[model samples]
Target: MGLLSGRRRPHAARRSIRALLAATLTAGLLAATGPAVWASERPAAARTEAAVAAPGDDWLRTEGNKIVDANGDEVWLTGANWFGFNATERVFHGLWSGNITDITKSMASRGINIVRVPISTQLLLEWKNGQAAVPSGVNAYANPEIAGKTSLEVFDHWLALCEQYGIKVMLDVHSAEADNSGHIHPVWWKGTITSEDFYTAWEWVTARYKSDDTLVAMDVKNEPHGTASTSPRAKWDGSTDQENFKHVCETAGKRMLAINPNLLVLCEGIEIYPKSGVSWTSTTPTDYHSTWWGGNLRGVRDHPVDLGTHNDQLVYSPHDYGPLVHQQPWFTGDWNRTTLERDVWDPNWLYLHKENKAPLLIGEWGGFLDGGPNEKWMTALRDLIVEHRIHQTFWCLNPNSGDTGGLLLGDWKSWDEEKYALLKPALWQHEGKFVSLDHQVPLGGVGSSTGISLSEVYDGPTDPEDTQAPTAPTALASTAKTSNSVSLSWTASTDNVRVAAYDVYRGTTKVNAALVTGTTYTDTGLSPSTAYSYTVRARDASGNVSAPSAALKVTTESSGTPSGAVKVRYKNNDASATDNAIRPSLQVVNTGSSAVKLDGVALRYYFTRDGSASVSAWCDYAAVDCAQVKLRVVPLTTAVSGADAYLEVTFAGGSLAAGGSTGDLQLRMSKADWSNFNEANDYSRTTSTAYTDAPAIPAYTGTALAWGTPPT
Candidate 1:
């Protein structure tokens, strides 16, 4: 049953009956098809954005090929599967190793909009019959948050957490019993658990949460598959409700919908299908088409699950895996996306989506990082999902998915960054930020750096379109600096409905291609020691933008070696308030044992050029003769917060030995008109008459630099 070997996968059903049983018994079968801000209330005036859990009417239904919210805005259910309630554990699998609350919050922050929780019919019936147990599977030390609760209570607590984080859930019937390897069975009903028990399980949970919309979906059953000549197998035909998957789906779907009409019912495909004119009575393997379990949907063309009054609630879900799970015939030789879609997927289940018969969700699709055919197959499926905007809950978030290693690594806390990067584009995102299913809270709760809410997506309710623009952001500041990036933060802007996102600007050009949904943004891909000015503007879903905020100036750190040979010092030569000329002196002192002798070493002083008068500079005095000193006045291409120009000073032929100083290299500057200049807010201005360390005056050495010159 381990995912490492294909022999134990679903394809074993294609072998001799004895081999098939061996594979089933040893196989841990699944997927070959499968599929914070706590309780704060909304403020009186929603105009001002607050990081709180607001309870908005969260109900969803389906249009032709899209799952829409109450306002009929298309929303994507991009998420992952967390299996455990269906297994012998009864609780989540990782609760033994990770904190349940932390795990839930982490998922929401990582753009998981919905969670497909695999559960067993036996477990639900147990809860109904008051057989709830404090699952011994959990390690209490790791999950102190729900240490004393029963498995049922833990699930309830998780639902509350989902509401707080703006995530949704879909209950999937993974198997008939609570056995660890129960998914290997071919039929929904096994042993004492009858098919009626399955229907009753869905009914009980549906009624329990009829008023709560967080549990918005119900997957009728896990993969149902069986080959010909296999008795007590799940069969699909355009006939009565014996073992026909279509009839069972219709029956269970109707029963669940009766309790709460807003729920989405997902129906999966079975194993083998009658080919062309072949009948179900045929026992010949060649007479039928065999695909991955729960992946053969050819029967949908003939016998579709009909929900008379609740047709909109039906969504056809199919599970597809890579070669590692079980390499079907089409996986060999030069296979590509075009071939796979046309040969395997088109006839199986993708047709339902292509023809707009119903909305499709690829309930399970993932595999190990084989870097071979498996990755190739996963890439093709991921591309299809992204191109068509198909809804999906990835195979798993757990790292223990045997054949298909999960999105999370073995540690459970650390994520498989590569796999997540591959899946990110398929998640529902707007303006570069992940989108949530809840209309009130954004994904990942309030103040999340990663997502926005459904109301932010479609401008709130349909009664009136959002027309009010968000308020201008305030208190913009650069919080952190790196050689190639700057992190910024500001107060949140308020909108009538919700602020969709924000736009960051450098000079006049928009630096961020997509709008930022959070209050913080780290602008990257910048040059070292570069001075940049930034501003921010708030935007609403209606495309209304607020006025720009006050600009903030930041200079990146130098990407160079440490300055050990010399240190630059400065002193204001004159502090006269009414002076027509400004004077300053800078001297490079050699601190290290080696002499500071290089043509590249220089010092720079920054100041604003007042009026249009041309400026002049000269070396007034130097320990070395003025002939060896050099000075230049340069105008800036972009004016920052307080300065627009800088004065550069350098020495040509002097070697300041260790513990020596280029003493008192004085300089002076003034406009041609002799206009008095104010240096109150100049970036390099200093009032201290005595010489001290001056980091403000950038100094440059041969291999090391400190803000003086632009990067080459």
Candidate 2:
């Protein structure tokens, strides 16, 4: 929600300065004991001690634009955000799905060194007031001992577990209230919560964890964005205390550092009107609009916050969203990946890192791992991060984000392996180091004798004797055939090493990105009476591929009559926002005597509001609890200019029997789908089996319905 909307203001008034004269004096005293004195008069033991100052401390500090450890070695923040403590639940999501310990272990195993935990002021205050309670069924998978503990106690235990796992924590003050809607309200303090209360809450939270090194940083405010003209409570000026973000940060940051100077203070940018005429670079405009909350940083170039003595502790943080969230002007208009980075990314936040002004941390950025433009955007962003060595934490580790799902899928147990594959390359631990499929060799380049040699590294597996590929899958046959789906089973293949996975293919198209470990695959969304051919191939872990197995053909039963109907269903996830997308889930039913052939289905969506249409479809057969039907989603096409658009979903070999139905063909219509979409007025949908040749269906001809109403 912090990334969706808002603008933050700059500081106007300076607070009472508290100087740490003790530390300054200590540093001055150390400087007075010069190297000459140690070299000229020190004893042998003293000389040895002088030659090697105690190994750099483990505490982290900022020097220039880098985050350095006690040893003065640069440390990159490779982490993931686990949200939900800030939500209405006020507890981490998926505690019912898996144990928090296991989740933390999983993150650590993947080389994630830190985890950003978002929390709310209300929840913290609730804990402070001893009113925080862990409801029943909330900690089903958590430690048995923590079942009856308070929210704060559970959080303390989580921190202990994180420390045991060597993972650091950054507490994010996401909202004043523990609800998703609370994030959109520009200022951190709202409703009953006053500005003083907001500061007091931070002071209390920071004071409680000041002694713990596991809790490393504090993100001052999530995303502050609103205008004086629109929402007077959310304006930014260098002179006002009520709505000025800079002023708030200075006061809050000073208090936080006073409790723990080792803590890094993360400051985010405002979304809109970031200092009317300020620009980070000449190419960026003074009045440029930041697409998401806390994304705009142009104002920083002119009016950087003065965090007093704790200035070096500052890290410029920003949030970025891809086309999936909202298709901004930069996403369209003949802009390719290079142009996007050059025109949009560079000026926004990348310039900060490039110019070495401050260490830039991408606080939030992620999208569905589905292969499409979003994937391309992710790739481009990852490449830029790698190229610049920018520190970042993937947007989330939970599976419940409505806008962008997390790195895990279904029940929050399995990893989205595709996403992991895409992100693993950009991991800082592997940066500038040669990593083999088996293990990584630190400093493992040209002449580092301590590391694995290049010849030994690239010479394939150490087991040279096992060169045989797994035998091709055999006895493949359809276990069951439906009008629109076919379930297949086959004899497992044998390998000298081990059969890793089996590949299922319809004609030449591969259906799954991740490997199919079992000897079965269900191909759905088939055309009735269509003879579809499928083949299976086996592969081993050593990259050995087997020949395709004997192909099997199956034809779906025919529909006795040509009488079927299509209807649409929708759900308004966030009805509070005027610019929210309408997620439509379609259902195709067969009213025919027999099975009906359904090679493809076409859907036309009409909008009552005056806005352009944008669509995104979801269909993955391998996904757990996923849509049972498989579809090759075509890109959106606007038929009636911007008023309406149609998207075609083609099946590999799908059909529908009499009284059978295709469960849910899910699709998302962007907020831009209608410039003025009337929530009160119901949208209409028309569908047809004839995909390529189907004519544009008129709206209100069939059944028209609003969200929550049953589709007839």
Candidate 3:
């Protein structure tokens, strides 16, 4: 049955003699007189129950109240947005069947419960002039390059699949050609059907889904264009456009009620005055572009004749975006606590709810453009939705390769783990329908926007203290020996909350630090036969640290060389002892068998003045810091054949090797910064080792091989 309208029945038959006698008896019974009763004492009850149950798919009209299951329990709709359900020619088309099912089921497991199906009227009726065939494929979008399948056929199949997954579907007519909403409109809506055109289309789809409980409400028009003053006067005819909407809506609502009055009727919001025009910047009106909320839609405050019914069985749908408020001039220019609450958000709510007397269902609001998903905005939006009991369907679910708008990609064959991780918790759920304290704030408060706030929602796992497992108390380390340095590695600890990073503690203090992107970590720089206890701790994104992992006792193998001496000498036949003063030459020799890693290297040299050692220059060589800089792979198993040491030299005002001279020289490393190449646990260089001799500068006798900045 269509939403708002209840089922109708055939004419009732009346009895003759028996009916007459019953009427006579009823009259006598009233004459017998009744006990005095207070009119105010009349028991109260809801007219809601006796009314034919509303269709389960009418999510918008119900406000926060959800359709109940057979058990009479509220059922929240948690599903993906199928914005790609248009013609096959569309690039972001979503493929259906097993793959979509698999992806959706995964979503279901993650707590998703409903699907918002976006379809273009043009695809359904325009292609075949209103008659079409359905396409077939394991992937809907993957239907072979055949043309026979019509949009109607495609939708029928789509609905069937939704049934298989036991998910409710909301068929949204994204656009209308006559008014030019957003999606391509069918030719029928392009000034073809007259005043009854919209109703006719509604009847066609509604009648088709009459018996399908899974079919939800229908949206009249996506985002109606033009306002009263700005719109053409003829377009505002009493029998068409706004007027026609009321006429068609009531008539269709009645017809739908005859079938099933349970269906919900959804209406999209208009762009009010002064709203951040970010979402509509490209298509904003030229002269009468809206700047006030209630002033735009005259009929809303005045209840124009076109708004079928009293706005009781209706839902108000609006769209919001972050860049509109955060980056645009409308909102950001005069941004203040008062402006955010009253000028920005409150007016929209007042019109949709107070004036219209309908619950709002945010049809589309998401991260888009280069703005991406702003967690701050998302949180605020969520809180506002929850506050008003407004339902919402994120603008898209597929990877929006064009303008930003998807939580996932359309490929459907694979999954994006990181994206999923970032979005999973932020996903709106059927449970906890109300805005929690963490996500709300009073108007004019110290928050992003007054009346709602989305900041600091993720404060780490608060409930279930065992969320993140603590690091082990004991330390376990595995060591490897090399001619220059000893390398050690260890395992990471378990945790309930996600581990942000790991710290490697030598003896009692942390010597190496690495981010916990994966499992293993390696430590360089060690003395033979030296025993050390390395502890690891798991930290959260908020900087909350967990107990240290078990200490792993490791002992390095002794080498023949002295504990911490490193010498540099010149190599190559063209080099000489005096080259140290001219071009400079040196080599690092580790006499010790235990492998050693110099976290950083620095050098002090003299350019012998009158046979006296004098300081000429100094240098520090180190790695550059990057967001994920801690991620690196330093080979600890280098062969003694010159591969054991990492070497490089830098000069000021360009390099002498480049025919330029006079510069400081030094060697530098992360000072035991753990690169997350291996598991977070690894050995670290403890003792400071230095090489006094400087390396010989390469001769620039020949053409330079495209010299550039050195890798920090």
Top of the candidates by lDDT = 1
Question: What is candidate 1's lDDT per residue for 179-254, written digit by digit as tens?
Answer: 9899899889999999899999999999888777778999998999888878767778767756899999999999
Better lDDT candidate (2, 3): 2
Writing each residue's lDDT as its tens digit, candidate 2 over 1-712 gives 0100111111110000001211221222222121210012222223223221121112466765667554233556767899888888788878765777777667766656667888888888887777878744366545564566656766877765554444678888989888867778888887888788888888898877765666778888887775323454443446546777777878889888888787888988776543244432222332334446787676667567778898888988888878888876556533345545644676566666654568887888888865877888888888777655577778888888887888878667788888887887665442133221111111222233232211122222223454555688899998756455677999987652477667787887654322366888767556778899999877554334567899998986564312123333333333433455544445555444556555433334444333445434454322112433332222222212233323333343466667776665555544334343443444343222222211122211011110122111
Q: What are the RMSDs of all candidates, in order?
A: 26.1, 20.6, 24.8
Candidates ranked by lDDT: 1, 2, 3
Q: What do the candidate models score in CA lDDT, each in turn?
A: 0.75, 0.58, 0.38
**Model 3 regions lying over 4 Å from their true place:** 1-80, 87-92, 96-98, 126-130, 134-151, 177-188, 191-195, 227-259, 272-299, 304-312, 324-328, 333-339, 350-356, 369-375, 414-712
| lDDT value, residue 238 of candidate 3 | 34
**Residue pairs with backbone overlap in model 1:** 1-28, 3-403, 31-34
Find the 10 residues in a row with the least total lDDT in model 1. 30-39
TM-score of every candidate relative to the true structure = 0.59, 0.54, 0.43
Report clashes for each candidate as comma-separated counts.
3, 22, 78
